[model samples]
Target: MAEYEALIIGLEMLVELGIQYVEILGDSMHVLKQIAGEYKCLSLSLAVYPVAARNLLTEFREATWEHIPREENFAANELAQVATSIQMPEDCVQRIIKIGKKSLPSILTTGMEIDVNSAAITEDDWRNPIMTYL
Candidate 1:
């Protein structure tokens, strides 16, 4: 509903996927901040959007609210326009779906010493469950 289309596009995709976390960054810090509740909303147009944003935010597992320069968000802005004007296939938007892809932390760790003969419990078992799924 805002002037820019990306914010609405990103939000729409998130809702479809049931995404729980999102980072909203834009040169429109005043707008973004107000939406994120970092500032008070003073504009009639701005006021309505933030209310809806906050309500949807409660659904995320963890939403990282932030603000960045417009240069950083240009790509998002363009995408928003495209998304607003037409329907985008999920495959076409794959790049935006995953902004970064770093390999997951090593889950396979081997014991430095063979202590099968000794029964020694390690605290790491509870500290990091994903280390060894087996």
Candidate 2:
């Protein structure tokens, strides 16, 4: 049920992003097969998912579904684990924060000390204060 919900949510996000073509991949063979029309979703509680997912696929000019082995889909598995671990309010909107890779090594290992009282700093200068706090 959670797998199907995730697929529906992902397709909705793609539509919101104005994506016209998409290749959907999932580790759940049952869900993928059901969505692909190769198998029927017999459970009353889960029947809505395949219908919702297929409806979402209509919004795209081209769409394809594929089932991959769970071992090959580590990223999705990790994301599902994270999603299940988080607890949020019903009214709260989810936000995705994009973080860039650090170009410099750790300050602790580099034996660098920060002078927090320095006046020659701009609003964008976050590293110094963060390092000092750490």
Candidate 3:
């Protein structure tokens, strides 16, 4: 679950940075297959993530996902392990990204952070809202 969430978050971050192409490599064959539309996600919460991920993938002009052996996935494996091992502080307000809903763009435009309430997201960036209930 964490790996899937991390993958989605990473893809969202890349899109926010205006990256137009991506090649995703992962050790989890199931996740790779799900993203590639070769496997069906069985869990509800988990299912939403892949939908969100695929939507984000559309932002890229080119995107590919591949599975690799766990032993060969060195950097990403280490990062995932480290991320899961850390304990969050109580004061840390973890933002929940509703599945299939575009995540708030992390990058500031023109050296200024746009206020969520004030910023007007154009149709070019805003697509269908997939997580209205959340």
Best by TM-score: 2
Write model 2 residue lDDT over 14-112, tens digit each, in one string: 897899999988889999899889998766556666777787789999998888898899878688699678767689798665433422222223243
Q: What is the TM-score of candidate 1?
A: 0.49
| Root-mean-square deviation of Cα positions for candidate 2 versus the true structure, in angstroms | 23.6
Candidate 3 Cα errors over 4 Å, as ranges: 77-134
lDDT scores for all predictions? 0.55, 0.72, 0.70
Stretches off by above 4 angstroms in model 1 are 1-5, 77-134
Superposition error at 113 for model 1 (Å): 64
The digit string of per-residue lDDT tens for model 3 on 5-123 reads 77777886798789999999888899888888989886644666566677778899999888889899898868869866876679989956343444333221113222222334465
TM-score of each: 0.49, 0.58, 0.57
lDDT for each residue of candidate 1 in 43-82, tens digit (9 for 90 to 100): 5434545555565566677877566666776766687697
Q: How are the candidates ranked when ordered by lDDT, highest leading?
A: 2, 3, 1
Clashing pairs in 2: none
Residue range with the least summed lDDT across 10 consecutive positions in model 3: 106-115
Q: How much lDDT does candidate 1 score?
A: 0.55
